[model samples]
Target: MGDLTMYRYDSYDQAIVDARVEEFRDQTQRRLAGQLTEDQFKPLRLMNGLYLQLHAYMLRVAIPYGTLSAAQMRVLGGIARKYDKGYGHFTTRQNLQYNWIKLSDAPDILAELAKVEMHAIQTSGNCIRNISSDQYAGVDAAEVADPRPWAELLRQWSTFHPEFTYLPRKFKIAVIAADEDRSAMRLHDIGLKLVSRDGVIGAEVYAGGGMGRTPMVAPLIRDFVTEDEIVAYLEACLRVYNRYGRRDNKYKARIKILVHEIGVEEYRRQVEEEFAHMRQQGLNPPVEELARIRAFFAPPAYETGLSDKIDRADPAFALWVDRNVAAHKAAGYAIVNISLKPQGGIPGDASAEQMELVADLADRYSLGEIRVTHAQNLVLPHVRKADLPAVWQALEEAGLAEANLDLITDIIACPGLDYCALANARAIPVAQKIAARFADPQRQRDLGELKLKISGCINACGHHHAGHIGILGVDRKGVENYQLLLGGSGAQDASLGQITGPGFSEDGVVEAIEKVTDIYLEQRQDGERFLDTYRRIGMKPFKEAIYG
Candidate 1:
C-alpha cells in the first residue's frame, strides 16, 4: 500500500473477513446449484454488498472513512477490468460499486477485497453502513481533530454487532470534525461533530436526519459526550431505535421517522436511560483501543521547511488550484480534489485506467493515500505544494482535471432508470444536459458554489433534498419529468430544499434551471451566492420567474 498510515488489520480482523468470504463462497455455490431460491439468497447477498439491479448484480466495496491505500485502489481497478465493465461507480457513502458483476463472481471479488483489508460488509443491509467522515479528515486545516479514529472505533463496534445487525431500517452515520460540513453530517441517521472544550475532546450528537420520500434534517440530541463515553451513548441511541422504531412499516422504519414521530426530547430521554444502563455494563471499548486506533492515523512524516509556493502561471492550473485545492493542516502541503464529473460525463463513474492512474498518482504525490469524497470525487490529501503542477498536469492529461468543484456542472446524481431498478426516470441524462448547458468555466465561476443534486426517485440517493438547487426525476404519465427544489443545504446550517412549484420534461427542466440561475443572477445582492440569494428572497422571485 506504499507506506500510507492507516488502520492495519490484525489477525482477528483478517480472520473475520476471511471467514466471511469462505462462508459467502459456500452460499454462492449453494445458490448457483439451486439449493436456495432467489428470495432465500437475496438477504445473504445484500449483507455482502451484492445487489440485484435491473440488469445485473452490483457489488459495493466499502472504503472506510473514505480512506484507501494505493494497493487497495489498484485492486478496485483490477476488479473493474476483470469482473464488471471497464468502470466502477463511487457512491455517496464513499464506497465503490461495480454494476455488471456476476453472482458467481461475487465470492471471488470478496476474496480479492480481503487481500487488501477491505470488504463490503453492512454496505447494503439494515445495519450501520460504512461509517463516513470528512474526505479531508486528518488533513484539513479547519478540523478540531481527525474524525476517522472515532469512525474507525464505530466500525469495530458496529461490525456484526449482534444487537444492531437487523434494525428497523438501514442506518447511516457521518462524523465531521470541522466547522464546515463536507460529509453531510446532519443528513445522516446519526451525525457526530467533534468539539474541544478545555483540552478535552467530545462529540456533539445529532439524531434522526435522513432523505427519502419524507426528508428531515437531524436535530441535536446532546450537546457533548466525552470521547470515552461517546460510543456507549451511540449504542444507547441505536438500542432505543431498535426497541421502539417502527418495524411493521418499511416506509416508517428509518430512525428519522421515529425521531420525528416521537419527538427528539423523548428519544433523548430513552437513549439517556439506556446509556445509563449500558455504562453500568461497561459497553465502551477500553481507552487503549482508541489510543491504538489513533496511532494508525498519525500524521505521515512530512518533510520539513518545504516551500508553500506553487507556480500558478498556467491559467488552467491556477483555476484548478482555485477550485479543487484546499489548505492542508500541514504547511507546504495541499489537499487536491480530483473531479470525476467530466462535462457531460456520468458523475462519479471512473474507468479502470483512471482508477489505476489515480492509484499511481496517490503513490507518487500523496504518500499512497487516497480519499473518496461523499460528492463522488477523489482526494489526494497530502500532496506537496511544489508538486501540484505535475499532479495537475498528469490529471489534465488523464481527463481527471476538471475545475468545477461545487460548480453547477459538478453535479451529484444517482444512476436513475439508466441502471437502478427503483428509479422513476433517468438522472444521468439530466445531469449530462445540465452540465452541457453550463459548460462555460467563467459562467460556472460567476454562478459560484451551487450544489445541484438529482435523484430519480423519492429514495433520495442523489440527496436532492440537500442540494442548493435540487432536481428530482419523476414519472409523469409514463414520461420522464423533473421537479426543481431550492434552498436545501447539507452543511452545518442544514435544511431541506423546497419544491419549486411544479415538474417539467427533461428538456424543459434544463431550461427551468437556466431560468432560475438567470433570476438569481439578476436579483443577487452583494456577496451573495445562488443559495444565499434563494435563502434571502424566500423562493418567491425564482418561482415566479420559472412558472411565469
Candidate 2:
C-alpha cells in the first residue's frame, strides 16, 4: 500500500521517538539488572504503555485516531508474531494491547514501532492518553469536516506538554466531525465536535464524562470555540482541572468527578476565565501547521464517473453488504466495517495471520487505509462500491466476514480475568456463549441494533455502562456475580444504563440477556430498535422478563 494518505514523521518527529526508545531501553535494562525495584520502575514502565497484567507484561501500542497504513499494520502483525503470542487485542481506545509481552523484549518492540513512526507513549498512566476520533473521519458524508487534522494537532500539543504530564488522573480526548457520535465522544474526559457555524468552523466542547464506578455524561462546556481558538480553550479547560482537580482520592481524581462536585456552571466560569487569560499567549498551533497536517487527510484521487451500483446476487454477500457497508462521501466508494467479533470468538483478539490478511485486503480494496473502530472492529474506509462482492468473498474465505455489526451477537467485551489483573470474573467466556447462542445471522438481523457491552470490573474497560444491554462482572462475597443493566447508550443520544434487580451466575446472565431480548423482540414497535424500545417502554418489562 502507498503512504500517500498517511502522515509521515518528519526528522524532528523521528528524532524524539528514537530518543525515547533509547531512554526506555536503558530503563528496562536497569530494571532487569536489579538496579531498580518494582515500585521504582512501575511509573517508568507505565509511561511507555507497559502494564503488569494478570499473567505477563502487556504492551499497548498507540494507533492515533485509529488510522493505520498497510505497512504499519504488517509491522503490528510482525510484533505479535515475534515478541509475544501470535495475537494482539485491539482496544476500545483505538490502540492495540499485546498480552503476553516480556519485560526484556519491551524496548525492542518500541524500536520496531518507532521505525514505522508509531509508539506507545501516553497510552497509560496520568497523562493525556491516545486521542480517538470517528473511524470514518475523512470519508463520512455527514461529517462537517475531517477531524483527523485537528486530532493530529491536539496530539502534537498534548504529547509531553509540561503541565499536563502529571495531571490529577488520566485524561482522554475524542474528536468527531459528525452529528452522530460514533466514537462515544461524550464519554471521554473531553469531547470535541467539529462544527461549522455561520460559515466559520469551530468546536463544540463537552467536558468531564467517563464510565467507571461512577458514570456521568459530560456537559457542554462551550457552545463554540473557533478552530483557531480550540487549542487555547482546551488548554484552559485542562488548566482549570489541573489546578483544582482532586489529588487526595484516586477514586475522585478524574476530571468528571471534579466537574460533578464543583458544578458545571462553576467549572465553565473558571475555564472561561482561564481561556481569556491563555488567549493572550497564543497557545494554539500556527495556521500553517494545521494546513500541513490537514493535507495528509485529503480525499484520495478517486476515479470519477464510476458506477455507484453494487450487484447483491448471493444472499450471504447481500446480508454482509447490508450489515457491514456504509455510505462513503465519494460517489462510487463505500466504507466497509470488518467485524472482529466472529461468532464464538474473542471480541477484539486478532491473530497475526488475520492482521496480515486485513493489511493485504486494505491494500487491494481500500486506498491503503484501515480504521480501528471503538466497537472492537476493523474497517476498510475507502472501498469502491463495485468491489463489495470481491471484498466480501475474500473476507468470508478468511473467516473475517461476520454480518453482525451492531446486532446482539456483535458484543463489546474487555479481556477479563483471563488476562487483566483487575478483573473480578471472566468476560470472554460470557461473550462467547452469548455469541454462540445468537449465532444465526437471520436471528441477529431480527433483533436489530443492540449494543451489548461487558466489563470484567467497574473500570468499564468494555464500556458496559453505555450498552443497551450491559453486563458487569462483580465479586460478590468471594463469588463471581454478573449484574445486568438496561437502556444505556454511547451515541448522540447518550445515557447511562440502569441496573436491574439482583445479579446472576455466569450462565444465568446469558439466559437473562436472552430473556430481556425476547421481551424486546415481542414488544418492539414498528422500526424501533432495541434501545428505542427500551427507552419508550421503560425497564419494567425487561426487569420482569429477566428477574422474575
Candidate 3:
C-alpha cells in the first residue's frame, strides 16, 4: 500500500496526536504501578485501541478506508517485525491488528504510527470509529463523486468529539461512492451512498443495519439529502441513538436493536425532530472546504494509453487474471486483488516480508498505492494491464497469487480461541480443515462465488452471518460445536444466513460443509452459484443433506 494521494497530517493534527501519545504513556505508567485500577484503566486503554486478548495485548490501528502508502506499509512491516510478531491481520473493519502487542510496547507503536501521519485514536471505544469507504473510491466510473474526502471529513469531525464520546454502544459509519455496495454499507450503524439527481449530487442514507447474534439489513432512512446537509442529518441520527439507544443490556445496545424495537418510522421521526432544532450550528463544513478536500483525491498521473495487451499465453497467469483482476474505469488499467487466502492460509494475515514485497510491488507497478478489500484481501488498484505478467510473477514468488478470490476456499474466519480471549472455540483450525477438504482449485472453481464465513463466537467478527455457508463455533460442555447457516450475502442482494438443523462436532462440521456443498454441486443449474441455488431451493435440500 502507498500514500493516500494527497491527505497527510498537518501541524494541528500531528500536535494533537503527539500530545495524546504522551498522555497515554503516562496513563500506562500509572496503571502499571499501583495508582489506577483495571476498571479505571480499561476504558482508557481501549480508547487507544489496545485490547487484552487471550495471551497478549492486541493493538488495532486504523487504516482509514483501508488506503495506505508504500512508506506506511513499510513502517507497518517494521512494527510487526520489531514490536510484536512477524505479521499482522487485516480485519474486516478495514484496520490492521497486531495480535501479540505488549502493554509497555504499545506507546512506542503509537509513536511510530504518528510519524506516518496516522494514529490509533477513535479506533476503539464507544465512539464513531474509522469511516470506511469503497477501496476504489475515486477511481470507480460508477461513482458520483469520490467518497474518500467525505470519509476523511467524518473522521476529522468525529475524532475525539466531546459531544458523543460516551454513547450507548460503539458506532460504525461507511460511505460508498460506487453505485454498487462494496463496503457493506447496509451493515453499518450509518450508511451513506452518494447519488445524483438531475445533475445535483446528494446522499441516500441507510441506518440500523448490523451483524452479530442478530443480523439486519439497513433500510433507507433518507431518499436524498444535500451533501452539505448530510453532516447535520447524521448528527441528528447519532444524537437520537446516543440518548435513546438501549443501555440496560450490552447485547441490546447497538442502534440495530434500537431501530428494530422502535421501528424505522418512529426513529426517523425522532431524528427529523432533532435535526429541526439544531440543523446549522457549525454542523456542516463549508462547500469551499469540501472542494479543497476533493482536490487532494484528484486522479494520479497514471501513464495514459497503456497497451491493453495481457500475456494470456501463460494459462496460470490467465487463471490468475480471471480470478484476481477486476475492471477499471480507465482503459489499459486493471484493479489487481492480491489474495491473502493462499490455499489454507489465514484470510488476512500478512507476514512482514510479504508486506515489504507488496510495498515494493505497489511502488513499481501500482502508482505507490494499495487498497485493502473488505473480503480480507489486498488490492493494487491502478496496475497497468500490460504490467499484469510482471506483477503476477512477483506476487506468485511472494505466495500471494492465489486464484480463488470468490471461491469457496476463500474462507473468512476470525482468530477465535487461537488468539482472542472472548472466543469460545477455535476458528482458524476449522477454517483450515474446511479449506483443506476442498483443496482442489478446479473443484473450488466449480463451486463459484460461494462465501463461507466462520465465527469463533456469537459476536460474528468473522462475518459468518453474511456467508452463503456460514459456520458459528460455540462451546457445549467444554466441547467445540459448530452450527451451519445457509444463504447469506454482503453484496447488493444482501441477505442474512439462516441456521440449519442443530450442531456438529469439529470434524463433523467439515464433513457437513462438504455435504452441503455437494448438494449444491448436484442440484445447481447451469451458471448458477451456490447462493443462487440455495435461494431458489429455499435451503431445504441443503438442510436435508446436512441433517436428513
- Give the C-alpha miss distance for residue 279 in model 2, angstroms: 1.1
Candidate 2 versus the native: TM-score?
0.99
For model 3, the run of ten residues with the poorest summed lDDT: 1-10
lDDT of 3 at 283: 66
lDDT tens digits by residue: candidate 1, 362-436: 999999999999999999999999999999999999999999999999999999999899999999999999999
Residue 120, model 1: lDDT of 90
lDDT of 2 by residue, 355-419 (tens): 99999988888877899999999999989999889889899988899999999888999999999
TM-score per model over all chains: 0.99, 0.99, 0.98
Q: Give every collision pair in model 3.
A: 1-69, 1-70, 2-68, 2-69, 2-70, 3-69
**Each prediction's Cα RMSD?**
0.8, 0.9, 1.4
Cα deviation at 322, candidate 3, in Å, is: 0.4
| Ten residues in sequence with the least summed lDDT for candidate 2 | 1-10
Write the candidate numbers in order of decreasing lDDT. 1, 2, 3
